[model samples]
Target chain A: MSDGDQMTPSRPVRLATRTVAISVFLLLIAGALVTSTGSGLAVPDWPLSYGKLMPPMVGGILYEHGHRMIAATVATMVGLQILVLGFRRTDRTTFRLGLAAFGAILAQAVLGGLTVLFLLPPAISSAHAGLAQIVFALTATIALRTSLFWSRFTDAAPRAAVEHGLRTRASRLALWAAGATYVQILLGAIVRHTGAGLAIPDWPLSFGKVVPTGAEWATDGVLAHFLHRTFAWAVAALVVAAALALRKLDAIPGLRRLSTLWLGLVALQVALGATSVWTGKAVWATSAHLAVGGLLWIAGVLAAVLLARAATLSPAPAAAEVGEPQEAAA
Target chain B: MRTDFRSDASKSMKTFPASRPLWGALVPLAFLIAACSPNAPEAPKAPAGPAGKLGTAVVAGRVTLEGAPPLNTRVTMATDPFCNGQHPGETELPEVAVGPDGGLENVLLRVTEGVSGVYAAPAEAKTLDQKGCAYSPRVLAIMTGQPLEIVSSDATIHNVHAAAKENRAFNLGMPAPGTRYTRTFEKPEIVPFRCDVHPWMRAFVAVLPHPFFAVTAADGRFEIRDLPAGTYTVEAWHEKLPRQTFTLTLADGETATHDVAFPSVPSA
Candidate 1:
């Protein structure tokens, strides 16, 4: 966006904002830990672990209650972020973004509570996991928007970016990639929550076949696993396609760097996914896979937002500048 | 709109302290989150078991199906080659073992209520053997706080994941044959025990306080001997059917008979 519309906050404010995103990402890893270690139902109470605010952090209770404590902390951080935005009372757009983030985090916390209270129903648990990505992306975006880099970043003129329609093309591709990545995360959540991560048993191949069929199709576990694997490929393909398409474009240097990072994250995600399976869903490997998936999702979302912003980068033109009939038709 | 971001950025650092409100906000939320859990079980409320001489009363019963039994789904063990090799080609689980006379097998009978006195757990640990890649004694009954020794006979990797809610849940892997693991549950709940390595392998563990419990045999006959003479509440539980609860009274050296039939379940 143009410098005039950019929301610039000080370094400390930016760091405080990024801290919320970092904590939420850490919370995501803890949630993954709860599922990876089969500890989802370890803490047998709502909002409390073993009826206490803090139970003996032994066995599975460690993962389950650890997630809760982090979640509680995340909620507080979100509330304080909104309060800080309000206190500044400058950058009204960021204040609104903070308000939106507050709403999302609250919803995320309530979903988490319901997931535990209801004994980790696959649907609620999956929703809780899926929303975590959104919450992280939101907070991350707030942090991104408030950074000095964002304030200083001004794009080339619309006339330059509009020719070849590279800006429009890159933005569309990035949005599609982001959407696919989010769906892939949801599918991964389903695979985790339904106890389907190991349903196929054999990694890189399902029951020693390219495509598993027959009786396994009738079970929820196999079905969830198959869908997740299938959709992961789709996500990877979309991301690479976006990155490749953006490579042919020009004038969006920030987005180009992000595209490369997105590609690298996707490759790491695939390797982690396989390693997680090969390790028999080991706590560390599976948790790492999920953690990497969280990072990949953040990058995907950031790329999309950045590309979209860059596509419309030039400040809104005056009424006299609307006479580019060729560009408008294209 | 006049926007001077450089000056605004300088002003923001002076305006905000992020930690103070965060700590203040967390305290109230913590209290609210803990509100619903006021009476959650601390630790399986003092183990309850029979604490007197074993009586001679016997409760014999036959559980018959009122209608046709549901078709047990074909269990696929293709994921684990060892399990798949043990039972070749599409094996149906023994969940719905119905005799010609409509007698149902694997129904668990427990005296859920009216059994008095806190009994001490038996010194001898109950063995839950995993043979033929399936949990033997598919429906097991044991006292709370009684040790359960899990032993696998298959020379393959297996893990016992007891998906217990009331009691602490555990997932222990058995990497080789004859690997033994012992655990004692503290609460009275039907724990669904399964081998995570073999998804098709599953069993139910009935953790009861007293010893007045029996599982239906091949012919659907269940006999629980040594139950004390008293009016006791017996619960008949089948995995797929609604549980049946009834009261039974017995005298010393008396043999009481109870015949129960569960409602028809839809065929697969």
Candidate 2:
């Protein structure tokens, strides 16, 4: 039912969409690097770096300007996807999806500009970061939908007797996980932006306690960091639940592999977060923490889409492997 | 990387980049023009500071703190090897520097009002140096249109960012040791300067229309000499304490000794 029979998949559009997704992810990391290095105000001008197209990349300028450059790259790739998807309106769903993504990217750019112009106010900066994840999830979903895997899965779905029910459960769980990851990302942004990442300074312990005390809560740094840690556990629980649910169905090796990847990313993301605070907010650790967070959001989204698609597709177990030469082929 | 992210932003900040070649050429030009627009305020003209030797009337003072001295915390400088190498041992920041005699260091005293006239800026330039990864003379005052030359003495990079409110803000990177850049403020405001590389490094500059301001010395003494006698409103500022202001009417050749004890009026 989710399938778009009108879509004539083009390899170039899919490749471009994936490229945009990857670039946006990198741009997010670059942005994290700028914040980690305290380079947001280094250039001190909007839509430009130091009154020039390219100021000498040195010091904070390197991180700040580098981020702008990557954002531009992401914009260009998104533009390319937009052109191909809307050409002759060949695929209405994909084209509309691309247009929506294009709109989000445009808004993302505005938020980015406003973040700089406002001298990095925490609220606006955090919003800028939050929207970036949305843009990433959108482009990443676009990539997933345009892929050969998506085409194959949708065409040959519901191959197992128990798959529909299991996928329905997994799809719901994955959606919740994605939402949790997004919330975690927002919390993490606050922690980073508010400089609360090291308020506790000790891992597996909050100033030597497993839980925050009343006195600790009085300190804003402690509160933000505590909330980030607490939300992370919730996110991990949902992701693991979804992964296990997918595994329970024992159908679609690809979905199983994606779930495993999500589980691995969750574990790695937590470690990077700890590494960030433990290492005194090292650029690499904090940036990777952000990068991994972006990936988790996208992966959760992909899992949700694929599982939901698998659950709703027409049952075609006999023709799944051999292909429907008579019906689908024509 | 962890060191970079581990800042206690709750303590000091409520916080939180790209692009092109030919496209960059045009876009940044537009921004540059907007920055250079005439909407910015102009500096007061003619005799803004004290006329040389015009008045013997002097406002001398000691700024003292009533409360316990601030706990100067040790800043983590491990992120930059250059900064770390500069301080081999534990170093506490001069957040509240009080001499043994209780004279507070780094309190800025300026004639805020009742002294009117366009003050000509001196030709000699004021210097703001970044040495040993610290800003020299943490608090200073300058007349509007007076050039402030910013220089870096550390081999590492230091971006001098002026957190200006009444004037156009600027952020410029001084990458190498002895890299010098000059700028002037066109408005009267208290501008806070900071280094992005070393968050603990801070300096404050009071850009005044007149040269009637002085930062307290190490012994908590501040003397703004040769003031043209007149009624004036003097304000004293300390980073850790509330700013205190006093009203005085000094006659020609009169030296007024004023003492400021903080936990200022409002706080008291």
Candidate 3:
């Protein structure tokens, strides 16, 4: 209606947030379906098919074209979310996060095009997948922020606490955990795109050997597989450590519950990873493993962000910004 | 009201804010955008024309094995034959060159260049498909103007790399898992199709110009047809046997059959 109406402080309800979150999750599931069906090249030619807009969607063409269609829908809705943020005059953090998410969506689109034009080159495909994980994390973060837990997670008290010197260790620990989780996500991308999953045919032991020993170990195939397997071990260790650290700060019920969920997700992810290998890269199982990995990484990052925010929320010597609640924390 | 003060504060803070490196993200975005350019496979040349089809030819043979029943031997005739105008003497022909079970070896016949306005291919020419891990028909006879279609029926991939002269060479990949392809040669060339994927998979395609060829049976019997009522030289050739040549004349509406015995050679 009017400019004033656009700027009016109209807080979106929790139901709307849940609906958006569910939609994003469904989009991820659809993507997993595309990969599992091996429809990546259903439409061999890109940008146009058989020199027409609607080429016959037979064979691989249907899968690839369907993936593009769903991706476009996701991009449009995410863009709409950014517009809504602008119109609603949400928190400065919310507006900035929306802009970042929009940029990521555009980047993801470009990457998808590159994946096609490059004939699915392993490196670009891997990077495209890594960026997708980041987008998934961003959407999940937005959902987290809009939920009832948002205000508890973004408590602006952390920066003031660092200035006042209380609960400082907890904030630093959570930041490190978040960074580690991000690295784990990148490694998982490398594992999938390098075609290394089958290199070490047998699970745990590579080529019936303990260490994948020998001078040939320096090769890209061997190295990528070895690094991925090693990182799985590291992920297990870091996730357990992060959960323990969060356990020490049990006062925040939300963070504790999230930490436990994060640990459970990590365990499921590792089991899926092994099953993917043991099952000869069965399409359905591999896709499920990918999906769970994305959810686990997002959950890990969300928990770290929330716990760090809560750690900084301990009371201070002086009351500031009275009679006003802090903007939704996340 | 605190509104004016807050507006001024926000505006001033925005103006003096740190210069964010937009290129930090833009650089990677550009890198990703340019990632896969110039990587797709180039389109191949368009196909030349419609492929030729298979035709029928009447073949009959008679063979006489000396001092034996010629049980499991073969004799053949050819049209458009590769005689090269050369024939060996009858006395020089080897004895017992045929297999113990009466199997005949090399027989060169011709679908001679022209007969009654029709081209005659060399007799005794064959195309064999090493299909299903077994030779298709276990025997074949090919003539001129016929391009052989060698197919793989095994569940594994195979390559048909014909090792022959007088034809272009090709080492093509087969479709994976239950895939087959057909290729034709317009000229006579003995090319061996070998599967590099499965080196054990191999077949031979003999290209000829006319339709006159036969593979000898286990009984050493042979036949020649459409002789044009003229005198012509006949020869038998086995890849493993010394060749034998004979002279015969064909009259109109008459079929000529001959039997020749091949003796085995002593071990060196």
Candidate 4:
């Protein structure tokens, strides 16, 4: 009845949420494929491929059309998820989040079509990509919230008063890490859409220095590339700080493991980012880099949510007389 | 304190319902693997048409400049030191090449109208070379469905960016010398290719439904052979001059000769 009371979501609702999350992940990968292979304009006409529903699948058309197909599938899955959540789940937060995801996916589809119809304008394409990540995050959040682990963990555990400050700090830090990572990913989208990936022409060092020099500093492409790299370092630092904070808390059973995982993912992401520049944006390296980036963001958000749950369950001093020992048993 | 909480949380976590296995995760992976795999079916080839019969009529002609040819500015390759070093002194880009007596080279000539039959594109590929940081045969013509082989001959990287309005645009990177990339345009368009790395390197290609287009040579001569007898409008285009078009009628077993001249303007 209360926020601390665990409400078990129906199996169907959980399954649908998980499905939407996976679908969103796949859609993100498809989007990455389109950008990586330079196949955004492979299918010039949208909604219909070359004036037909099914175009001759070849060359860039495969990536473009396949992206459209994956998008459509994800849209359908989101629609279904929203229906299940609305009918079965009484909790308004998850229901509304599902609906919001639906709206985002619809907007994303429109943006995708407009991007093709308008000939891959940088703004529209970048927005489409940005929205995909947001939608993926939303779906992942819903999936995590609906999971049985989340429900039981929040309901059964009564955090000790001693752990309250640490949990709050960890939660806020994780939230900051997630927000910073999203901003970095958006910058990455700009760098990619503007063809700024090769602006620096060298990695680890921009134009053989920590910062761009001379004409490289003046060019927009080079500036964007440099910002992306700079922001990456900032994000890496934030991830490390968040990981350390979570490790110290160690109150949540799985939070420590998730933090370690974030460290590994961030390291892998940095390697992939460097390899992307070194390999001249090789398709595989760049695509993997994007996928890992998305995963890292997801990990950050999940850690924040779990820690916030722990913070909420921290025993209140005034409620100490209200069955504290039974709550501890839980 | 942490161990006490951990034991309690693990016990409660065990009581929690089992999350559903991620079966749906495999669907996207399958789709992605299938999309990226090389074993997918190839695009259908363009339909084959009857080959040209022997002894077909030919349209042969010369393109010339009527006045002093437009002076082409020198290409500055200072952005990439490698390209700049290739040219010892000032390197002038050959935009308008005019010989003695006003012979104009690099004029693109196409049969604009009156061709009706479907002409099969030759299987042999036409190559456009990137050497010395410039496109060889700056102006080229090909029939629709003909494969274009873009070969990079310079050590520096060059991206062949085809800016086509009617057809799909492609930007491909050739990172090493001797790298050959092939592309085919399905629609008729006058596509311009530029190197984004070296902004000054430019090339134009005209793709037509029929194989009746030709680019004028150094002596300003171009011959469109195997054109069936017909009254057609031939259009001549020069990069620096206005397009000129004229109607011509070719009779059976007759060789027609026509000269198209472009009025030249002084360099800016």
Candidate of highest DockQ: 2
Per-residue C-alpha lDDT of model 1 across residues B1-268, encoded as one tens digit per residue: 1111112113232322223443354334544653532222233245535455578899998999887778887866664566778888899887777888988988999887777777777868888888987999888888888878888788665556677888876555454576676678887899998764455677999998778899998788999899777888889998778899889888999999998888877852
- Candidate 1, A1-330: lDDT as tens digits: 233464467666888898998998999999888888676755544444433455555445567778888888898898899887677553766777788888888778777766654456689899998888888988898888777666555334343454445656766778888888888889898888888888888878988999987887787689889888878898899889888777665455566677788899999999999888888898899899988998888887777776656655654455447655554453
> On a 0 to 100 scale, what is the lDDT of residue B95 in model 1?
73
lDDT of 2 by residue, A253-327 (tens): 487788789899999998998898799889899989999999999889888877767755744246556455667
Query: Of the pair 1 and 3, which is ahead by lDDT?
Result: 1
Error of 2 at B125 (Å): 9.5
Q: Model 4: per-residue lDDT, tens digit, B120-210?
A: 7777889899998899979988877888878888887665667787777655545457666667777888899876456568899988888
Candidate number that wins on DockQ, 1 or 4: 1
> lDDT of each model, Cα atoms only?
0.74, 0.76, 0.53, 0.76
Measured with C-alpha atoms, the lDDT of residue A190 in candidate 3 is 71
Clashing pairs in 4: none
Model 1 chain A, poorest ten-residue lDDT window?
Answer: A154-163
| DockQ of all models, two decimals each | 0.04, 0.13, 0.05, 0.02
Per-chain TM-score of chain A in candidate 2 equals 0.91
In candidate 3 chain B, where is summed lDDT lowest over 10 consecutive residues? B1-10
What are the runs in model 3 whose C-alpha is more than 4 Å off?
Answer: A1-17, A48-57, A152-170, A215-220, A315-330, B1-268
Candidate 4 docking classification: incorrect
TM-score of chain B of each: 0.78, 0.79, 0.52, 0.80
